[model samples]
Target: MLLLNSGCGTKNKNSFESDIIIYGGTSAAITAAVQAKKMGKSVLVVSPDFHLGGLSSGGLGFTDTGDKSVIGGLAREFYHRIYLHYQKEDSWKWQKKEEYGNIGQGTPAIDGDERTMWIFEPHAAEQVFEDFIREYDIQVYRGEWLDRENGVSKSNGTIISIKTLSGKAFKGKMFIDATYEGDLMAAAGVSYHVGRESNDTYGEKWNGVQFGVFQHGHYFRDSISPFVIPGDPTSGLLPEISEEPIAPNGTADSKLQAYNFRMCLSKHPDNRLPFPKPENYDPSRYELLARVYASGWDETFDKFDPIPNLKTDTNNHGPFSTDYIGKNYAYPEASYEERKAIIKDHEDYQMGLMYFLANDPKVPEKVRQRISEYGLAKDEFIDNGHWPHQIYVRESRRMIGDYVMTEHDVLGDKTVPNPIGMGSYHLDSHNVQRLIGPNGYVQNEGDIGVKPKEPYSISYGTILPKKQECENLLVPVCVSSSHTAFGSIRMEPVFMILGQSSATAAVLAIDAKIAVQDLDYEKLKHRLKEDAQVMLLSERLK
Candidate 1:
C-alpha cells in the first residue's frame, strides 16, 4: 500500500510517513529504497514478501544479464558485492572457488577487471540485498498486502494515503510502485494491460499470438496426440493440453506466458535433498511429457546453468518442462488467495514432474539415472521446504503510462524519450499455450527470440503515469511497454536500473514540489549520470 500526495497531516503523528513510499519486496524495490535514502529522502518499503530479494535472492541466481557493460548504478554494485563475498576463502562450502570455472552467458562469470560476479548462490544474493537495507537504515514492513479493493485514498488526482490488509496506513509525498505485479499502481485507479495486445495495435511483428514461430526447442517435434487415449479423441483430452482451437497469428488474446520455479539444485552428496513427492501426485498429468521423451528429446539438462559452489539454477528447457504453460493467465487480476492456489499448483506440478523423471518406471532409465544424481540445495530456502519462495513471473500487468514502449523502441527503430536506462537483451518470450496444432500433433506456441538491433535507452515516461490519472506515482517493475518490447526490458538488471531511476525521480519530484510527470528531464538525466547509471552505450565505453 502507498500514498502519493502528502501536503495534509496524518491522523496520528506516530504513523509511518516518508518522502517516498515503495511497495513490493522485489530486487527493484530494494534498489529503489536504497536510492531514495541515498538521495537524503526518507523511504519506506511496504513488502508483501517475507524475504528481501524477490527472484534474485529466491532461486534465480544465474543472472539474465544481457549486456554487462550497460548494467550500471546499484545493479552493478550488487554484482560487485557478490564478487567481494566470493573473494573470501570461507565463502565456499561445497566446492572450492577455483573449481567453479569462469563461465557465463558469453563473458566470464567472475570478471576481475570489473570487480563483479554475474553468477552466485541464492543466499549470497539475499545477503547482499540485506546488507544494502541495513547500511541505508531503510524502514521496511514485511507481509503487508495492499487492500486492492479499497486501499487507495486519492484527493485531486493524487493519492493521500494507502492502507494495507492489516489496516496499517502509510503517507508519502511521492510513491514508487516497484512491484512485479504493479498492484499498488492498479489499486490507485491507474490503467494497466493484462495480456498481449494485437500486433496491429502497436505495429509490432511479434506482439500477439505466435503460433508457428518456435525459436526454442520447447515445441513438439513428434506427432503426439492430446487425447487420453492415443489417437482416440473420444477418450477426452490429456491433462495440461488446451482444448481450444489455436487462434490466428498476430491476433490479440488474454493468454499469458508460462511461469515456473528456478530450482537451485546441488549434486554434492553432503548438501543435497532428494526430490520430495508432493501431495496428490498424479502421473497422468505428465502424459504429454512422456510422449515428448519418447520422441527422442533428451535435452532435459540443457538449462541447468551452474553457479558457485557446485549448484545449478535449473530452468525450463525442453517441451513439457517446468513451465506450467497456460495456467497463469488469470494471475495478473486474480485475488491473493487465488494467486496462492496457482502458485501451489505450479509447485505440485513441478515437484511431480521431477519425481516422475527421477523414479517412475515409465521414464527412460538413462534419464532417471542422470537426474537422480542432483537434488535440491540443502542450505538454500531452508524455511520453505528447500523450495524457492518466489515464482518466475516472466510477464504481468503492464501500466499504460505517459508513453508505452513498443518493439520499435527495443530495435532502435524509434527514438526513446527521456532516457533513464538501457537494456540489450534479445526479445525473449516463453511458451504461452500448449494445444493441438493443425497437423493433429500437440505443439507449443508463443516462444519467440529475436535479437535487438542494439542496446537502446529506456524512457522515463514508461514509468510515469498519465498526469491526469495520478500525479506522484512511479512504476519500475511492471513498466509501460508492449508485449514484445517488455520481453527485452523485463530482466532483473533492467528492473534494478529502473528502480534506481524511479527513486531518483521521486526524490527530485519531492524537492521540486511537482508531479512526477512534470519533472525536468535534464535534471533527472544529470542525477542519473551522477549516480553512475549508464543511459548511453558510449558512456560505458568511456
Candidate 2:
C-alpha cells in the first residue's frame, strides 16, 4: 500500500494532483519539495525507497564539500538544522559532544558563527529531512516505484501525468526528476547519454577513457598478477578482472565508475555488530586483493573518515577496496529486478570482502587485528539490517539537454550562461574497471581527480530538457553533463542547491504560463537570490 499523507486526502484516492511532482526520495527531492511549498505551490514526492535523503543520510555522513562557502540555499539550511540537533545534550548518545572533535573536510565541522555542521550521522541527516517534510507539510508517497515502461503519459512534448507500479497515478503541471538514477526523466522519453563521451566529442581533455592517467592513488602501484595462478594465462583471468579489450586513451566507452555502500561503522563496544558473512561467501573471490596485499600496498584504512558518535563513514580508498568495479555496466538501463540483483551482488561482494579481511587466515595478522576492532553500527539503519539503503551511484544516465556541461565548463575554461548554482568539488571519478594492463599485470582504470582553479557556475539549462523533448520536466541529480563534468556536480550539497533552484524555476514557469525552457532567467535569478541561494562565490564572499 502507498504511504500517502494528509496532503493527498483532499484528492481522489487512486489519482492525486499537484502543482509540482518530484519523483525521488533523495536529498534533492526533499529540498525541491520544501522550495515548492515555500513558494505556496502544491507538491508531491513519489519516493521509491522508504527512507529519505538518499546518500546524504545513507551512510555518507562525511560530506564531500570542496568549498563550503559556495553551499547555500536550502542546502546550507539542512546543515544548520543538523547543527541544531547536535546541540541538545541527549543527541550525544554514543560519545560526548566534546569528545567528537570539530574536524571536517579540512575545516571545522561545527561552525558556531555560521550555525552549520557539515559532518553528521546517518540518522541525524534523515531526521533533518523528515523535519523538513513535517514542517513544510510536504506530501510524500513512500515505496512508490515509477513504472518506467508504460507509466509516463505525454502530450506533444509535455508530461501530463505519471503512474507508479502500484497503479496509482499522479498529475502535476510541472515535474522534477530528483532521482539518482533519473528514472522519471528517462521514462518521459528525454534524450540522455549512458556512458563516457570521448574527448573528441566534448572537445575536453578529461572526458573519456583514462587508461594510463592515474590522478588519484586508486591504481596498482606495484605489479599485481591477474591470473588464477600468477604468471599463467592458461589458468584463466581472475574472477573479477574483466577480459574486454581496452579502449584507447581519450576514447569513449560504456563502462561506469564503481559503486559501493559508504558504510557507517563503529568502534564502540556496546553498539558494534560483527561483519555478517554472506550466505554465498567465497574467500577465493578476493584473491586479487590478497595479492595486492602481498605486493605490500597496505592503505586500507586511509578513508575511514570520522563522523559524530564514534562512527566512521568508511569509503573505498586503496586499489582493491570497497568499490565493486566492472560489475555495474548494465545497471543504468537495467530493469528493476535486474538492478535488485546487481545491488545484491554488490552487497555480497562487499560483505564477503569484509569477512575475508577479518577472518581469513591468508590475510596478514596485523591487518586482521586492525579491522577486527570495528563493526557495523548496530544503532544505524535499524530497519535494513544495519546496511545502507542507498548505494553510491557515482554516475548513471545523464540527460543530454539543450546545453551539455563539459569538462571545460567544470574547469572554468568556458563560461556558463544563466547560472543557477555553483560547484567547487574536484572532478573525481572512481575506478571504472580492473583489467589486465598492457604489461600483463592487474591494473585499475578510469580513476581521475582534477581540481578546478575556482568555483564554477552550474548553468540553468542543465536541469532543463531539450525544448522538443519535454517542456515541464527538470532533472537535477542527473543533469546534462559529460561523464567527467558530472563528477564535480554530483555531491549532496550541490544536488540540494540545484534541487531548490529547479523548484524555483518550476514555480515561476507555472505562474508565468510558460515552459521551463521558456522561463525568464532574470526572474529565476531574483527568486534564487531572495531565497539565499549562492549563485556566485564572489558575490557571497563580498
Candidate 3:
C-alpha cells in the first residue's frame, strides 16, 4: 500500500497501488467495486463502455433471473435501488404499477420484496447502476479497453500491474476480471477455452453435443433455398448460412451463436419511431426470413415484454428473427473497429428484417401491421440510435481453473468444495450452426435446454486460478466452467452475485497478503454471509 514513481532515465522505482482494480462497466463490475469499497478498500472500475451497466441497462430491462431467492448481496441491492427509484411515482410515465404485475418470461414476481421485480424499464436499471456508483463513490474510467496481449504483468504467479490500450498503467493489489470475454484472465497467462468441449471429454450429457432439439422455433421442416438461386448447388449457400456441415455428435468445434438486437420499442405514438432501412439494406439478405413468413410462421411479437409506460423490450422469435444465426464467429477476438463493423452488419440485417416484414409485398399483412405498430424507443439508448450498445455475449473464453463445473455438478450429482454463489437457470445455449438435414431440409444445431433439478452451488475455485497460474486475478463474469455448465451460470444476476463474492475474496486476499487461491474459505464465507451474500440455501432459510 505505497505510492511509487519509477522515474525516467534510471532503473528507478516507486510504488503506486489500489486495493482492487475492476475491469468492465457491467452491473457485475460495479457490484464488485462497491463490495470492495464497503470492505474499506480503495477501488477503481475501468470499463470499455461509456455506459455503466452491460446488458442489464443496455436494453435487457426484462431480466432473465431464474430463482430470485438465490440473488443477494450487492446484486439484490441493485434491484432495491431500482425499486426505490420507482417509488417516486414520477418513474412511471408510460404505465401504472398495478397494470404491470408479476409478468415476465419464466419467473414469478416476489410480492414481499419490492426490489425483486423481474422486469423493469431500461432507464430505470441504468439509473440504479449509476446510483450505486454515486453512493459508493467508486472511481470509474470509461471508454478504456484493456491491451489484452501485454496488458497484464505478473511475478511469482501474482499480477504486478495491468496497462490499458492508452498505456495508462494500473497497479492493484488484487484485480477482478468482470468482462464476459475473460480477457484479463487470458492475458494474465491463465488457461481458458473458447467454444464447446466434446461431450465425451467431460462425460457431460449436455456439453458439446446437441442434436434434434428445437426450443426456439428455428428449424425448417421443408426445403428452403438458402441462396438467391433456387435449388441450384452452384448458387451456393446464402451469406447467413455457413457452407460447412454441422459437426457430428460429441465433436468439438467453434460455431457462432445467434446474434440479435434487444429492440426497445414502444406503442406510444409520440415515442415510437419505425424501424429504419439500414444504410446497406439488401433485400436478398432476408430470403430465409421471407421463406419463414411464407410458411405461416406468425410469432413475431411473442417476446415484446412490457416495461414502464407502453414500452417493450422486443426480442427475436420464430425460425428467422433478430438472431443473426451464423455470423458471430469473428466477434469474440475481433478488433474494436472490426467489432463495430460486425455490430453494424447485425443492425442492418435486423433492421432490414423489420422493414421487410413491415413493407415487403411478400409478408402477410397481419404480421406486418403487428410489427409496424412497434418502433424503437426514442428515449432509450439515445447515444446509440436507440439500439442496444452491448451485444448479448452468450458464451466466450471460459477459464479452466482448479475446479471446472460441469453438467453433473449442476444436476446435484456432485458438489463443489468451496461454494461462492448459486444459479438455477436451465442449461440453455442458442443454436450454434445451421445445417441441411438428411430429409433435404435446413435445420439449426447446438440448441440445448436441459433444466437442473435444483439450484447448485458455484465453486469458489471456479473464480480463482491455480496458485501457480495467477495469484491476484479473480474472474467472476467468465468463471471456470465447461460450455454446458456455463449455460446455466451465465445469467446476469448470477454474474453480479459472483462479482460481489469475487471482490470480497480479493479484499480478503490482499489483507492476508496471500494469493487469491490460498484465501481462507472460512473467513471468506463469514464475510460473505455478513454482507448478505447467498452462499448456502440453509442460510436463506435462516
Candidate 4:
C-alpha cells in the first residue's frame, strides 16, 4: 500500500472527523457525499469550484448517458430530482415537453417513472445538484483547492488529513479522490500512469492499434496545398499538421486525448449575447479552419441541439472543430497559473473560432449566416460572463491500480470479478494529433471509435490503488485502465455510479478499520446492492 508522508505534528484538529472526506465538488464528489450521508455517516465535501456540480452543471446539459438503466443510486436520484423540478408546469418556460424534440444524435429520450427530462438547461442541472446538497444537509467547503505539494498527512499507510490551498485542513478516517485528474491520489503518493498504452502491453485489438485510422471520415487530402510548397521537407508542415509519423502501432506513448469547451449558445435575440472577438484574437490561427471551409466542410452547424429559451448546447463535431487537439498535453500536471493560461488559450481559440465563422470573409456565406444567428447564453455561468465554467478534461493521469481494466475486459473476453458499475458508451477517443499520412494527406490520429457489443463491467479493484501502494484513497473518476479502455468508462453517468460505489467502499473501510485494498468484496457488494447501486451488467440490461 502506498504510504503518505506523516506531518510534523501528531495533533489532529477538529476532534470529530467525518466518516468520509470528498475532495471535489464535481458530480462524482457530490454523489459520493450524498451516498455516504444516506448510510448515516457524517460526510464533508470540499471543492475548489464555487459551484457544486462540475461539468454536469457546467454547460453539459445534454447528458452523454449510454445505457441509462445502469445508472442507479445517487445517479438515478439526481435524474429523479430533475424530473420533480420539471413536474411543476412553470418549469417549461420556452416550450412544452411534447413540442421539444426528445431524440437527438441517435439517443432517444423516454419518459420513465420519474418526470425528469434527461436533457435540460445548465441552470436547471445546477439547481438539482444544489437541491441534493440541501436535502442531505451535507457540510460543504467551496473554493478549497488541494495543497498538492505538502498538504496531505498520513499515519500508518492511511491518510489522516488533507489541507486545502487556503490553509484550511480537513481530517477524516476515509478519503475519496473524486476529482477528474485524481489530484488527491497524486498528493497522497499513489501510483498512477499518464497517456496511451500500446496494444501489445494489454494484448487487446483496439488499444493502440488504430492510431491514425479515422472511422468518422474526418481526414483530408494532404496533396491539397496549404502552403506555397506542398510536400517538400524544406517547405515545412502547415500550422496544425505535425510531420511526425503516427506513432507506430502497439507502442506506449505520452499522447493524451483532446479537450474542448462545450459552448452554451442561444438564438433568442434578447437572451443571446453575440459571439465576441476574444482578447488576443489572431486571424492567422484559424488558417486550418479556413482551409476546412474551403474544402466543402459545412457540417459545423449540425451539433447545436436546442435547450430551453432557444439556447443550444453546442458540441464538437467534424474536422477542425472546438477540440483544440494537441494543445493540452501539459494540463493534467501543470501548475495552477499554467492551467489558467491553458484554459485561457482554449477559451481564446474557441471564441475566436466562433467569431471567425460568423464574421470572416473567407467563410461561405451560408455557413457564416447560420453561425451568426447564435451567440453565448447571457444568463448561464454568470460569474464567467456566461462562458462554460469547466473545461472538458477528456483524459488524464489514470491510477495503475490493483486490477487494470484493459480493452479485453471492456470487450467481454475477460471477466471482471468485482464489478462496481457498468459503462456502455462506444470506445470513443478523440484525435490525439494532426499528422501527414503516407498518401501526402493531412490526417488526424488518435481518434478511435469502435462500438461495444454490450455494456461491460467496471471492476472494483480499479477504484483503489494496489494494496501495497495506497490504502485509504478511492479514485472514481480516474480509475485504472488502459488508454483505449478508458474511452468507454469515461462518461458522466458512469462516473456518478462509480462515485457512489467509491464512497460506499470508503465507509466500509472506515468501519472495518482496514485499508481500502483489504475490504471484502462480498461485503462491499452487499453494501452496494443495499444502497441501490447496479453492480452487474445483466441487472442493467434486464
Candidate 5:
C-alpha cells in the first residue's frame, strides 16, 4: 500500500514514485496523509521536521475553536481518539482523573456520552498523531531538508520531481503544499503575496494599519516615556520601541505582526524547572516593562492560563509582554541560518524577561514574589530542553489563486460559492510595530480586531491556483485570501478541515485525470459528505 522505491545512502540513486507527496510536518500534514490512505492512494509525507503536528503538538494546548460543531471528518476523529486514550486508568499518571476536572473553553470537557475531548497536553496530542501514522501504515520520511535552490524539476507547468538535500528524489503524480510559509508553492512558479495590502486593493476596511482604532487593552492608556532618562530626548529610546513613522489609517505596508512561544509552565514542586538566565541576558532590555509596571499595569499574570495537572499554557499578555514585536518581519522569507538566529533571539528574550521579573532588584518586590511560583513544566518538551519545539508563525505568504477571498465573503455581504469548509474565529491580528505616539509617548500600531457577522461558507476556488500556473498542485494551508480574511480562517481546527478536504480533492483529481480546478464540485461535495465532513453549520448541527 505504501512505497519508497528509491534509497539515498545505501541503495540505488533513482527516483521514488508515489501517487501523492505531501511536504510538511504540520497537524494538517498528518491529517492529509491519513485521508489519502483512507481514499485508496499510495502517499508519502516528506517533512522538514522530525516530529509531526506543528502547533497542535506544540505548546498550544488551549485551542482557539470558535464553534465546535463545524469540526468533522478526520479532524473530528483525531479528537475522539484523544477521548478514548483518557478513558484508561493508566493514562492519568501525573494527575488523577478526578483531579483533572472538566474545564475547557466551550462545551462539556468530558462529554462522557459523546466520547470526544477538545483539550489535552502537548505529549498526548503528539501520541495521537503518531497513532494515525501507525494505524494507516503511512510512509513518512523525516529530517529530509528540501533543496529549494535547484531541486524542483517542472515541465509544461507541472512538477515532475522534487529532490532533497540528501540526494533523494520523489516523483509523484500530484503534490500538496501544506507548509505555513508556502515555500513549495513559491518554488512552483505560483503567484503569492506577503504582508498587508491597502484597503482599496480589496475593498476591505481592516486590511491596513489602524492608528486610531485600538481594539483591546494592548495599547497604552496613559502616556509613558520612551527614553531611559525621563522627560529627556538625548538619552536615546529604549531597545524594543521603534522610531519609524506611523502611516495614515487604512494605508498599506509590508510589515508583519509579532511571534512568541506558548510556554507550558507548572507550579508543582516536583515537576517545575527553574528558569535560567540566558548567556546574553541583559536587564536593560526590560526597563520599559519596569516603567509600565510602575504606571498602574499589573496584568502580567492574566494570560498564564491553566491546562491540566496544574500546568498552564502561558501566552502574550500586555504591551511589553511575551510577543517579540517588530523583530520577525524578515522571518517568513529568511534563509535557514537566519531563521535559526531569529528563533534563538526570541528564546533568549522571553527567558530573560522571566528571570528579570523574578530576580532582578529593579523590579517591584510585589510583582516578583507572585511570578516566582511558576516555572517550566519538566515533564513536557523533554527532548528540547523544556522549551516548545515550534514558534507560532501567525501569518505568512498567501497564494493568489483563482478566487481571492475578500472581506465581503466573510462579512455575509456576498455568498461564498462552492463551499468546502467552515471557519468562525475572529478577524484577529497582533500589533505589527510599536512606535512613538502623538503625545511623545510610545503606542502599539496595527492591532485590528474584527469578528464575522456570522459563520460564512468558504469558497473552493480559494485553494486552486490558476490553471496556467500549475495543474497538479493544491495549496490548502496558504489558500488565496486577503490579510483580513486569512485572519478569520487561520484557526487550527479549520486548517485540519481544509487539509482533509484538499486531500480528498487530490485523489479525486488523480483518478479522474483532470486538473484540480477543472474537477466538478458536485462530485467533490458528495465525497466530502460521505466522509462525515461538515460543510454547512445548519446541516452539521442537525
Candidate 6:
C-alpha cells in the first residue's frame, strides 16, 4: 500500500519549496535547520509553538545527559556557546559567579577546557537557539500548527507538501520530523508505537507494565489505605486512585508514562512568583500528599536542582510529586484543544500541589516552611505567568522503521551498525498510573530504570522509515525505536545529536541524488565524523 521514495524534482520554483522542511520548533528542529544550512541546503522550520527549543529552552535546565564525550558536533557546540555566554561577568546578574556554585548530574556544570556548559537557564538556552537561527539565516514559521486532518499531501510515499493551520503551504525535497510528538511523521503516514510494549516484543528486560519494580522512591513508602476513610473499602477509593485491575507484569498495554513540567523555582525574594491558587484549584486533590507527609517520607526539596542565577530546575521526586500519573494517556493522540485541556488540568494539579504544600494546615510545619520558601522564578518565562511554557514530554510516539532500537541495544548486548549518534542515559520511564496495590494501598506503577553499562550507538536506520513507507523523510527526535530503547534515546542531547545527524544524512541524500535509505553509509559516516560527531567509544569507556 506504500511506495518508496519518488525521485522527482520540485514541480515548481517557489520560496516555499525548500531543500528540506523540518517540523517542530524543538532543540532538534533548530539543530537540524542549522546543519542543513551549513551543508548549503535551504531549509525552513515549521513550528507549532511560538518558542523554539522544546525542553532545552523550557524549564528543564538540569540536563539529563549521560556521557559528555558521546555528545559532539552542533550539540556540543550549542553547549560551548552556553559556556561562552556565562564567561562574561554580566551573565550573572541575579547571582554572583561564586555565589551560585556549579552543579550537575555527577559532573561540574561548567567544563572550562572542553568549553561546554551543561546546566543553564531557560532563557539562555532560547538565546542560543535564536542565535543559531539568526546566524544561519534560517527561515522559521513559528506558532503554525499543522493541519493534521488534511494538510499533508503525499505522493507515492513521499510527502509533497505540508499545509499549516494558517493556510500556509511548504514544499521540500527532504523532510525531518523534529517534533516531540512526531506529528509530521504521523501525518505523513509513518508507523509509530505509542506506549510500552511487552518484554517479549523485543526480548527486553525493562519494557512492560512493572508493578513491583521500583527504581526511585516514587512508590508509596508505607502502606496507606486507598479508601477515602481509613480502613473501609466500602467508603470507596480516593480521587485519582484507579480502580482498574493492574495489568499482568510484562504484558503489553497502551498506557503511557507520566509527564510533568520541569519547573524553574527561585528562593530569591525579588525573583519569586507565588504559586497562585489556580482557578478551580481543589485542595482535596492533594490529600494523598498529605498522607505521604503523614507517612514520614518528607524529601520534597531533594530535586530542586540548581541552574544559574539562584534558580532551580525542579523535577518530579518522591511519591505523589509533580508527575500527574495517568492524566496524559490521551495526549499523544488528542486534538489540539483536547491537549490544551489536558495541559491545563496538569497545570492546575501541580500549582494546587504547590499551594497545598505551602498553605495547608494538614502539612507538617517544617515541611510547609521549607516548601514555602521557593516559588516560580520571576524573570523566567514571564509571558507564561512565570510557569514553564513546555511540559517534560518524556516519551511519545516512536517510529517503527527498518530497525527498532531495543533494550538489547540500550544494554549494549546487540551491535548497531551505521551509528549516527549515541545515547548513554538510563532506561528511564516515569510512573504510568496510580493504582491500588495488591495490598489495597495506593501505589504508582510503570516507573522503571535500568542504566546502561556504557553509551551505545544509535543507528541511522532508527531515523529512517521503511523503504516502502517513505524515503525522503527522517525522524530524529522521535526516531524508530521500541519503548525499551526510547527510554534512553529520548533524551534532549541525543535528540540534538540525532537531529544534526539526520539533517546531515538528508544533505548527503540530496547530494548523491538518491533516496535517503539508498545513500552510501560510508559517505554519511565520514561527513558526520568531519562534523565532530562522536561515533565510537574511546578506549577508557570500553
TM-scores for candidates 1 onward, in order: 0.98, 0.98, 0.94, 0.94, 0.95, 0.96
lDDT of 3 by residue, 1-542 (tens): 22222221212232235678898988889989989889898888889989888889877877877767788888888777666776677777767766766566576543344455667777888888888899988888888888877788777787777888876777877889999777788889989887889988898777664757666565665567776576776877765676676566878876646767777788888888888888888787778777877776777788888777788877766666788887887777777788789888888888888888778878888877787778888888888888878788887788999789998988788867889888888888887877666554567787777888877889999998877788888999888898888889998899999999999999888788778888899999999989888876675522
Which pairs in model 6 have colliding backbones? none
Best by lDDT: 2
Cα-based lDDT at residue 521, candidate 1: 95
- The Cα local distance difference test for each model comes to 0.90, 0.91, 0.79, 0.80, 0.83, 0.87
Candidate 2 lDDT tens digits, 1-542? 11112233335678988889999999999999999999998999999989999999999998898888888899999999999999999999999999997889857899898989999999999999999999999989999999999999998788888999999999888899999899999999999998889999988898778898889889989988899989999999988899887888888888899999999999899989999999999988999888988888889899989898999999998888999999999999999999999999999999899999999887888999999989999999999999999999989999999789988998989889999999999998999989888999989999999999989999999999998999999999999999999999999999999999999999898888788998889999999999989887665632
**Worst lDDT 10-window in candidate 6:** 1-10
**lDDT digits (tens) for residues 296-401 of candidate 5:** 8888898887676678788887888898989988887887788899989999999999999889887778878888788899999999999999888888888999
Model 4 lDDT, full chain set:
0.80
lDDT at position 92, candidate 2? 91
For candidate 1, lDDT tens digit of each residue in 1-542? 23444433446743677788899999999999999989898889999998988999988888888888999999999999999999999999999988998788777899999899999899999999999999999888999999999988788888877889988888888888888888999999899998899999988999899999988888887789998898888999999989899889999998888999999999999999999999889999988888888878789899999988889999999878999999999999999999999999999999999999998877889999999889999999999999999999999999999999998999989888889999999888999999999988788999989898779999999999899999989999999999899999999999999999999999888888888898999999999999999998687732
Given candidate 3, what's the lDDT at residue 102?
Answer: 59
Question: Which stretches of model 2 miss by more than 4 angstroms?
Answer: 1-11
Alpha-carbon lDDT of model 1: 0.90
The per-residue C-alpha lDDT of model 5 at residue 95 equals 76
Better of 1 and 6 by TM-score: 1
Which ranges of candidate 4 are over 4 A from the true structure? 1-16, 104-106, 221-236
Cα lDDT for residue 390, candidate 4: 91
Per-residue lDDT of 339 in model 5: 86
lDDT of 3 at 208: 67
Model 3 root mean square deviation, Cα atoms: 3.1
Q: Can you rank all candidates by lDDT, best first?
A: 2, 1, 6, 5, 4, 3
- When summed lDDT is taken over every stretch of 10 residues in candidate 3, the lowest stretch is 2-11
